[model samples]
Target chain A: MPAPTAEQEQAIRDAVVRGFDDQVRFLQELVATPSRRTDEADAQRLMARAFEDAGLTVDWLYGRGAGDMKGGLVANLFAYKALRAAGLLPEGRVHLQSVPEEECTGNGTLSVMQHGYTADAVVISEPMGEALVRAHLGVIWFDVDITGTAAHAQEMSRGFNALDAAFALIVRLRELEQHWNEITVGDEHFGDQEHPINLNVGVLEAGEWPSSVFDRCHFSVRVVVPPSLGSQRAWEQIEQCVEEAREQDPVVSRGHATVSRSGFFSDRYVLQPGSEAEGLLRELFSDVAGRELEAFATPAYIDSRVYGNYQDVPSLVFGPVAESLHGKDERVNLESVKRCTEIYALYMARWCGVREG
Target chain B: MPAPTAEQEQAIRDAVVRGFDDQVRFLQELVATPSRRTDEADAQRLMARAFEDAGLTVDWLYGRGAGDMKGGLVANLFAYKALRAAGLLPEGRVHLQSVPEEECTGNGTLSVMQHGYTADAVVISEPMGEALVRAHLGVIWFDVDITGTAAHAQEMSRGFNALDAAFALIVRLRELEQHWNEITVGDEHFGDQEHPINLNVGVLEAGEWPSSVFDRCHFSVRVVVPPSLGSQRAWEQIEQCVEEAREQDPVVSRGHATVSRSGFFSDRYVLQPGSEAEGLLRELFSDVAGRELEAFATPAYIDSRVYGNYQDVPSLVFGPVAESLHGKDERVNLESVKRCTEIYALYMARWCGVREG
Candidate 1:
């Protein structure tokens, strides 16, 4: 694909500068709406209107996906509007989709794909700074429950402490973390990243009273799965760890503890290096930023995995840098948002073929 | 001391049978008052009135001790009344003292002792079924504060997990428990009771958020010290254990964690097996119950430790069997209360010498 001409690039830059204020206002308004999880109805309506104003067919796929995809959705809308103003409309179709429930499940994207929305190449704007995201580690969240016999603290020998079992499990988890860190997936794309697999024990709770022996304990953990070790293999490894722990303790081995994937599970998604969509995204990022865009895998799970792997569309993640995302005072950098808009416009023109008027 | 004459024993038995109804009513009323800790004013008033009714000089030392001593207070009252009614008042002065704060500290008992409440021997009525408590383990409650750097779970290596530090401390505590249990106090008084030393991890808490690395963890533990080890030696052992743990972990060794006795501490109390108070109580229990009373040490801390060790009084715990003393549905056997009254009356006649009216 040919790079945009100097005059065309100048036109695109001029249009982005002209529409920069509107893009900022749109983003701020969308973020201010506070669309967490499935609460994205207002944000969806705003994006749908913006898509229509940019002359693209819009589909409202009401769910959590709409919230996660909002940043990407708004950036796409403004990029299209800026391209049209510069007489750089792509000849191919641009179907803007706003889906739901993508944070917990991929039902929204699935429904949109089932409803016949198809694209040769897809770009998901999940906040990943300037580098294009071609792959992400899979995630599995689970809870382990350990049960023990309760007795008076004075009769220590008569009771089993569930917190002791929890400690045993935590030790096993630490060992598992070390083992996974030692594994090399042999993926050249990951490049110098020693360990992509991580295990986070997020929440733990046990024993109601200090004087009585704890009878029950429940803990939840999130495990990051590398592309080489998919969710199934990772889960099997966790089971083996639990099995080993059970063998070391009489209370745990007496069938007093259980491990279950009751929370969330998703497969790791990786796009082959030099894939058409991935190559196009990398080139566009480089062209827009005037620097080489390094590719790397993230431990975080994103919607691109759903679209690319499940929906069978070649998808990549490219977005602005947002510090402390999903935490206090989360804010996206406005300048990066504008730069991302220009890159999206150039990619559409090159991949979809520009229309000559 | 000579045993009570058969005629005097007959009179004591008859008096106990005659006062059985009043003793039952007094115990039930005392238990019904629900004087937990500092809330013992009502129970104190009732016991003071009962002591005066029994023709004994009563001192109301108000506080938590009033609640703990209410049962003993009521039993003492009715026993004195029964003895007087049967012409069995001891020649020596019988001063009934109701002190407070015995559950927390010995301030009330100390105050009473300072105020010239001296006795040849002290008999404290703590519920121990048919056995007489001549010795008991001391207790120390302390908190360990572990501080660690807080970082996002995504960058776990940058922060020390306080929960992990807590686990390391617990492991050390378990080792200490095993070490203490192996050392025999070599007291025939305890008699084949294995593991007089016990460590209880009562309360544990750490990290507020499941997704963030825990930066702080605080846990409290209770340790039982035999009469041989005492509170000072037990505490020193705990400090040494913490120091060992700190040496093993760099995070802990950097003074990121501290162990301090912030709550409660009490020295163990043990009366010589052949002391007048212990021997007399054992004979009285055997004479009344027609069975040899067992002498054993308990892990729980009680006010007898203060009186026997601190006040220079020969004190022993003897009382009725009560299920769930400090828990819900705490109850005492009315028949045992009657039997205990008979024994107390007989002891007054034999040890203190019955006063001639």
Candidate 2:
């Protein structure tokens, strides 16, 4: 697409500033909603209403959420047929690799805002920063149990210590650090070493008295792999590695540890630079930020991947650089919100194919 | 102390067995009261009441526990005063050691039981078999927390994974497991190749979000050490080892993991063999079992150590081997209880300076 004139850009900027004010209010309203995953109905409904209000066709569907355990909410916000005819919005879900956290995702109001914007390029005012933008990261989480016996310490010979066995796995996992790059589970190598598939071992409980023979212990684990890595595959690799380390355990023939699947997790979704969506978000974001910005390649994930996984619509994450989303003093800069709103509004105007002012 | 005549030995065995019955009931009742450190008030109150019921001249006492922590109880059981005056009972807290989980140690009751016997030779009734009648093991329970950051798998470059750090510690702990030794910790090898000082790494919890970073995880650790080993010394060793391991964690360099300690446990205690108590219990138990019996050296500890440590009362562990405690289908054979009660009653009568026909 040819670039808009300065006047046209300025006009878009004004609309964006206006959008910024509206988004600020919207964000406050969304923050008020308790839309955690546990309370899915409300979040889903709110997203549906938000998209509908933004003049988009709302499709509320359900799918396997955190595996066969929890159900997932799918609120599809597509360009209305009328808008699609004008080429104002894409026909399918914009497969985004960058889905912001819900509290910051804010009722998917940005979806509504994008729906409301009849444009050739739609922008979702996410909690991301106009400062950083980029590809994707995935998360892996699971649990492992160590089985052993318990007896009076004096009779420790009669029982295997579960906690010790579990700790062996823990120790093995730690050793993985040195060979992190050497042993690849998913992606060969991402640009960022810090963001590579890394393992996390958490949780453990074990004890004994004069009686018990042996018992079980648990460890919660998480790994961050590149977008190319599927959690199941990576988990398999990790489990095997743990097994391989057993013989090396200092406590010989104590017990065994087993790994299991976890219900809660999100995978990484990458918006490869070669993709049409990635280029578009970058160009548009560069113009707004008045500086070159890299893909928001922070080692985190957004909802964009789910969309990308389900639909073919290429999407890139573009928004304000968010701060402390789930931290003790989670907050965003007031100005960043305004900037993101302007950028999003401009994106929408252009994507809608609106003529220059 | 002179060797008892056959008739006198029978009377003492009867006293020991009878007293054992009373002690078992008391034990169940005391356990039901919950004497966990967390249940200080209730535990102290229950222990106090039991001591009074057992007819001990106990004085309730308190002290600063750990690091400015408060509230501790010390029960004085002069059960031996009567026997001691008669040149039978020994003076002291009947020291012993128990693996923490099996619910085996009966410090309060044993303290009082030592009272009536007032025998220079004291025997502790743990879940130890007749083989474990003389010695056992020692341990220190710990709750370890490993802290790390959770970043989206894609953006792990920016955060820490607590699970990873914990895994590293587990590995290190296993390495240290090589230091465990049966002769040192349990006084009996039990055919284990590793040191008897077993380390268990169990339990972990991190981020609620699948892809979200988990900041912290807690590991339940049970360290088995030689009854001859001081708990504080073992703990210091453990803490130092952990410190070194934390440094080895790559996360620590990346500003991710920071480890902490927990699980304030009692000291490890073991009683010396060939002491007056050991000889007496050995002679009495063998007579009751109707054959020559071997005193088992246990890897865990019991109250017999307490007696040896505080009151210089020579002691040995003598009791039934309750197969289940603090576990599924926990139970004790009624007949064993009755038989043990007779053994305990006999020990008491012989110490009471009573001679049977």
Candidate 3:
């Protein structure tokens, strides 16, 4: 497809500027809605309505998914709408897919792939501080349920504290995490990045009463595996770590700690440096952003894995600047949002080739 | 007061035998009732009905207090009923004080003392394997809330794990606990006991999501102070320990761990030996049990502290054999319950001076 002319580029920029205020308002309403896991029906309904308002066929489908995904999703919709408003439409078919559960599991996009939606390239708007993700680590969510003997604190020696066992097990896991991170120092894609793998002790619950030696403790951890290591191999190592703790560590030896997958057993994805899709996106992004596009490996999970890993297609993981992807006071930069919308519009015009509506 | 005649003693045994089945049933019903903290109204009502059936004025009242206190309360009621069944009554006035919150605050018994209830001697039926407690540890409950910077797990190096900080603090507290227990060696009452001071890490809660570095954690602990080291001093030492961890421990230094008293700030109680009350109890217990009364220090908290520590009266913390005072499947021995019922009956009749009804 030929690149969009200078006049068409100016029109795309103008359309994005015209809709910037509406885009910001839409993002504000979305951020205000409570879209916590399993309770995102209202947010999904709002998105469906927005898609219909954009004069697009609302394939009303439907966390951190809310954070990085919301701003990026809005940018996608507005970019598509901006093209139509600029009196243009893509000659080739383009499908705007909105899926959910990208935070805990990537099942939403995986389901979309299963429905056989093929494309020459795929784009995901995940907040990435205005850069493209060359590769991202996959995540494995697992819970460790530990059991120890319970006795009155008066006779504490008779009981083995489950909380203590869990803590010891966590220390062992951290050592494993450190080992994994150490190995990534010389990795091809992740090298030069400090501590590219993280094992997060996300949720912990232990004991019941204040005077009893805790008999049970449960903790969930999120561990990231680089694309070269693979998620399945990472899981095997995690299981072996706990098993060794049980057989060797005195505290864990006194108790039983079992590991089970809880969520997000996903494999890592990589977009190789050279591709026709990447070249076109790079040219379009430099024209709109007034800077060369930069790509780097992120030590976090993303939905682009569904296309790149499963469908073997070139998938671009791009997004606006965001703070706290999965934490309190999460926010996105409005300026980055506007720039990303313009870049997306330009890329779509050049990649698909604009035609008379 | 004259001792019971041989015939009266035989009648007391017969009266105890008659009410034995009902006492066991009452205990079973009480155990079956879910009398968890702040939910003991039903258990208290059941106790009130039992006292009424025994023809004593019901003093309706109120966990670990459950296992030892419930069985003992029923024994007290049945002992009074046995006296009436044996055609005898105490010439002196007897006050039946049934209080609550013994497991947590001991405030229930404290409230009774504040209500102007005074006695020459006190009897508590805490399950202690058919022995009397010479001295028991006081307990202080406190919670530690820890906060650290939060960041995405991909950027985990920028944030500290609050759960890790909590674990380090807990290790420091455990050292303090070990130091306290070590110093208790060669004490007067607790000299023979192994580890009379126990610090238990009970409840723990931390983190929110799996993909973010945990920023917050909260944990509650129960620490016991020997009768010699007052609760206030123990609390001071606990605060100092946490303060030291803040200054010295690297992990704990990265976060703010604030300590606050959650519940149970009570002084240790010692039932000094060779008192007239102890002499009478020893004689009565030997008469019925056909064995010498054994007394030793226990490393658990009890409600007897209210009378012995606050009222300066000889409070006898004694009871039947029990297993698991504050754990699952906690049980009191039925045979020991019968023997304790007989002993309580004889002690009350002799101490208060029985006469013709």
Candidate 4:
């Protein structure tokens, strides 16, 4: 298919410029209506209205998941609306989805793919600072519970220390991290980098009094998986690491430390380096920025991974610059949002084919 | 210098029986009064009245210490009164002290000792059942502050995890506990026991969320010191362990983890076996219980450690049976209090040399 004519591209850019106010209001309102885990109903309603107003079919996939996809959903809605206002409706069907349960689970997006929501190529529109995200690392969360015998600190011999067990587990995890880094060094994707994958111990709590030996200690860890490693393979490696740790110390083994998955999992998403979707996204990004945009991978999972990996759809992540996402003072830049809309319009017309009225 | 005559003992025991109701009331009120750290004034007032009524000079040593010594103070006051009533007032000076600040600091007792309150032998009436406490362990409390570079977990390499440092420190402390136990095994007072010394990690806290690398972790620990290892020597050994831990890992070394004493220290107190004080107390206990009382060292610290170690007073812990001292439902047995009063009366007649009244 041929690229949009210069006159047509100018019309779409002008439409995006005109819709700048609405784009800002849309993003601000979307952000104001919080869509945290299991509370995305209001954000979903907002996205559905925006999509329907844009004259596109809207699908709300509901489930129990953390709602980090709201910002991306709103961006996609406004991008579609801006294009339609410019009289640049594409001939191909544009199925807009406001998916829930993508943060803690990818079942929402997975359900959408299972229900036959297919596209030649898919753009996720998650906040990526406009440098198209072609890859994202998978994540697995687990809780480690370390048990020990509690006694007055005076009777140290009678008491097995749970904090000791927790410390042992952490040492083993650090060792596992080093081994993982060494082994994944030669892979084509996510290889030979400073930190391609990571194991993070996020939260920890132990005994109550310094006068008593700790009877129980608990900690949670998040592990980033390279695209080459499946979640099952990563989990097996972690279990083996725990076993090795247990073998290294009689006290830890006696303490009965255990590790269990925390019911949250996301598979690694990688767009092939030379895929058709990658080529189109690169061209559109260069057109919008007047220069080539660099592509990079994140040690974070996005909703796009579901459609890309599960449905075999060529999916890529592209969005406006957003700072501190999922944290305090999170925001998408207004100007970038407008520029993104123009690029999305141009990409839609070229990839989906412009309809003759 | 001779043992109390059977008739004299009978008169003292009868006097104790007469004051049984008052002794019960005194202990009940003392336990009822809230004398938590830094709040011993009310309890002190009650003891002064009881001691003065018992015809003994009363001294109030003021400050913040473990209020656990109040029960022992009341028992001594009644014992002196019963002996005086039985015409068994000792010729030697019988100074009754209601000292404060034995929980967190020993300055109260230290101040009294500094003020020239002298004794041939001091028997601290702490709650230790009928057994003679000839030796007790010391205690040292310390705080560990672990510092690490804080960064988003996505950027794992840029962040040095504080929890990791904490884990390394705990591991080091466990090894120290083992080493301390081994070295203290040959101690004459607390030798070859299962646990003569101990290290307990009581309180621990780390990162706020399971999603970010922890930047700071703070925990407090309590270490028991055998009589052989003084507080200063134990502290030096602990510092050395931390230094060795810092050398083991680059992240921990870079994190600048620090260990500092928490200003609460107790030195181990051990009375020589077969001393005049020990023999007199043993004879009195055997006469009351019709059996021998065993001598053992305790992991817990007491106010008696001050008089024994600081004042050159040959102090031994001998008190009535009490359940759960310094805890909820703390109670001293009424019968034991009566029996203890009788024993104290006899000890006063024999050890202090009864005057010809």
- Candidate 2 lDDT for residue A90: 34
Task: Give candidate 2 misplaced runs (Cα > 4 Å).
Answer: A1-36, A39-146, A150-158, A161-195, A199-214, A220-287, A292-300, A323-333, A350-357, B1-123, B131-145, B162-196, B199-210, B224-283, B324-333, B353-357
- Which one wins on TM-score? 3
Using DockQ, give the best candidate's number: 3
Per-residue lDDT tens digits for candidate 4, residues A227-332, read 6678888888898888877887776697788999984577887787788778887888887888897788787767777777777888878876765443333455
State model 2's lDDT.
Answer: 0.47
What are the per-residue Cα lDDT tens digits for candidate 2 across B264-300? 2445455555665456556766766776656544445
lDDT of 3 by residue, B1-357 (tens): 656688997898898988787776677677677676788888888877777777531111122444566888888888888888888898777777677777778888889889899999988888887899998878999999999777777788777889889988988998998888788888887877777788888889888777778889999888888656888998999999999999998789888899999889988778899999999989888877889999988878888888998889999988888777666656677778888888888878988888767
Docking quality class, candidate 2? incorrect
lDDT of 2 by residue, A45-140 (tens): 555575557632201111212111011111112212122223344323343211223422322424533554222222344445554335555555
The estimated TM-scores of all candidates read 0.69, 0.63, 0.94, 0.68
Q: How does chain A of candidate 2 score by TM-score against the true chain A?
A: 0.64
Pick the winner on TM-score between candidates 3 and 4.
3
lDDT by residue for model 3 over A87-151, one digit each (tens)?
88987778887777888888888888889888989888888978899988899999999988777
| Model number 1 iRMSD | 3.8
Residues B1-357, candidate 4: write the lDDT tens digits. 555677877888898888767765566677677675567788778776766566532112122111244555666787778777787657788877777766556678788988988788887787677678878888898989998766546766667788778777777887888888887777777775777667778779887655567778989898886566789988998899888888987756876889998745888887778788888888888889888978887877776777787777788788777653433334556677667777877788888777546
Residue pairs clashing in model 1 are A63-A100, A63-A101, A64-A100, A64-A101, A65-A100, A65-A101, A65-A102, B64-B101, B65-B100, B65-B101
Q: In model 3, which residue pairs have backbone atoms overlapping below 3 Å?
A: B63-B66
DockQ of candidate model 2? 0.14
Displacement of residue A151 (Cα, Å) in model 4 is: 1.8
Angstrom error at residue B340, model 2? 1.3
